[model samples]
Target: MTTTLPEAPPAEPGLKAGLKNRHLSMIAIGGVIGAGLFVGSGSGIATAGPGILISYALVGVLVVLVMRMLGEMAAANPTSGSFSAYADRALGRWAGFTIGWLYWFFWVVVLAVEATAGAKILAGWIPAVPQWGWALIVMVVLTASNLVSVSSYGEFEFWFAGIKVVAIAAFIVIGGLAIFGLLPGSDHPASGFSNLTAHGGFLPNGPGAILTGVLMVVFSFMGSEIVTLAAGESADPQGAVTKATNSVIWRIAVFYLGSILIVVSLLRWDDPAILKDGSYVAALSSIGIPHAAQIMNAIVLTSVLSCLNSGLYTASRMAFSLGRRSDAPAAFGRTTDRGVPRSAILASVVFGFVAVAFNYLWPDTVFQFLLNSSGAIALFVWLVICFSQLKMRRIIEREAPEKLVVRMWLYPYLTWATVALITFVLAYMLTDTADGGGRDQVVLSTLVAVGVVVVAVVRQRLGRGAAHDAVTSSKA
Candidate 1:
């Protein structure tokens, strides 16, 4: 009798490979440029002085390394689970289960946070609507966008990213001219890099401030890796990963670090405007731009909405992937005929709604706790990606080198260096104050990291037990 191989399993629902190259490319562009850089960087600059540029550059380099690792693995084996699936294949089941849940948790928390922030701005524009009502409206709109199709999410992001790109480019051009004393009515007289050193000097706070600044800057880069996750669903996964990984770095540096350079160069490090307003627009207003705050508010509102939309989509898809992998309840794996994971989307959105309620009811207690706990997971995810890529590269080289389209530079060396640098950042976090305040975000973050490690270990054992049982039963 002839032996025949079994057929492959059917693809999971709401998990179709429909995203195109353009979607992946734009998603990569949009994911890196979050509202945080626009709204949150002012405080960082205020705290660290002109040296904050170093902070951004340090974090920017780290992001490039991490994204490269992710691209290397994602190009090899594209999947919606992206890093989680790579962790499973390259490391172990526990790695996959832990990281997947952690990522899903991270995004779900982000969904609520972004929605609330976006709603606050929307309410300002349309005061007739209550803040909570605006939150509900934002959630409903993005959820509808996601439920329609992945392409819809892509289209939304393309425009959202386009607006941001155009805005940032204009800001850079105008701001650069002002910094160089070229613009009309420019009073600052070129400043000539003196602001960076004139105050307390570049390292006024010392080299240690850079570490403290990392706590803020690192989080700004959190969403950049989302592109690799979304690319798993693209028509040409390898191609998408290649383009995104190659181009995203310069975009991030120019848009983020470059814009910050302009801001700092135009104003003193200790300007009252930086502290009172806490945004680029505020900084611009301090520099004498009319309608600055309103312009910034509008830009930030768009950024918030963009983040909320992406957050919902990321969380649901992660949940859907987890369910398909048997790490989550099977129900979440089910997709609608339209290839949308309706149940998973609903489940994530419900949690987001609860978070919004929590924010409203106990703003101080609940929101603070949520922010602290989820603070360190982004690093955890990056560390896992590094390790996963480390293992995956060797395998790909041995088994299917031809499939390795996008390879990490200085393989194994730079890869390991990235790992060491991440370890150093975590260690540094333990000593550094959160936001330059006495409060210790490091301790809270460390606890979360330890908890995730414990969970990963336990899950690995459980997966092994199941595998062993299956083997024994087959033998019997």
Candidate 2:
């Protein structure tokens, strides 16, 4: 006689599938393009010169591999918690708790970062408003949009992302034409493919600078995984994940590598204005575009707002997921009548507001430290995704082969290679000279990661102890 098994508890209701296909498409595109690509890339160009293309290529490939691994897992079990949920299944509660909280922390800080970045531009346009006030206004508007409903958030993101996509594509096409002396008003007779090596050779700063460029630009790629998280809320998660995964290659090749190739070719990589004004603006100016700086500033502002909007959405969803798992306050798990995670969004916005305050009060001290402490978390998150995929693939194969809608290219081999490459980048980051920002980022980020690890370990142990005690009490 077989013993009857106890029925499992019903799963808690989660975020509504309000995100549409167009929303996912734009999110996938916009997620990969951030303000860093517009503004921060100038530093990388200065550091690596023309070799920055190689740097972007390396990091892009790394992201693609990581995303492939992530897609394999997410397609199998799409959820808003994303890799955090996979870590729970593949590693343990400790891994899940640590990575989830760490990721949430990263984005909350990013909300502050993006808000400040956008505020600077807004304040530039209208000096009547203080920078902090602009930051406050931007944060309040986006938070209200998110709180209203997930669809509202998606609608905002869709249009914001669409503008970015069109802007970048247009830039690439016009710049490419200018490089070949085809654009009508582009006055640069010297512009051509030779600009790549004509200056001081392609690797002007030497080959080592490529790795330095990697360290500088890798963080720009941080938001690409936002697609996987957003997919869980889409109408068809598996399909969305698969489409996003397949599109990663072309998106990186075209949007990043293609655009950068045009920029470097049209203007000398060593142009002083590239660093002073920005790479995109300098490149546009080289093509004789009127008001290039103003145009790029507008694009950068759009990107900053886009990043801020997505950051709030991602952080709140992670919090909501944690709540459902009992890893956070239960209030975070509750949804509004319209399926909005009101408490979760507000909780995320609270930290964001505090961060904004810290920015105003301690812009150079505590806020700077907070920025550094979370700097390397993108790499850490990607590393966790790699490891989770390693174990998750096997579990998926054994337990639910039919659910494997997306598959990693080389299985464990390429997966292991991706892990090795990421480790190398991290190790390189640690070895960066003290004068540069790399070493500081690694050290501060490590400290923050360690603190989170300690919390996760303690929480896991206490949870296990409680479970054991409950079992004992039931036996009694």
- Each model's TM-score, in the order given? 0.92, 0.96
Q: List the residue pairs that clash in candidate 2.
A: none
Count residue pairs with overlapping backbones in model 2. Answer: 0
Q: In order, what lDDT does every prediction score?
A: 0.81, 0.89
How many clashing residue pairs appear in each of the predictions shown?
A: 1, 0
Highest-scoring model, TM-score: 2
lDDT value, residue 436 of candidate 2: 29
Q: Which stretches of candidate 1 lie over 4 Å from their true place?
A: 1-14, 185-188, 433-476
CA RMSD, predictions in order:
3.8, 2.8
| Model 1 quality (TM-score) | 0.92
Task: Tell me the spans in candidate 2 whose CA falls farther than 4 Å from its real position.
Answer: 1-12
State the lDDT of candidate 2 residue by residue for 180-275, as single tens digits. Answer: 888997797755789789888999989999999999889999889998888878789899999999999999998999989988888788889989
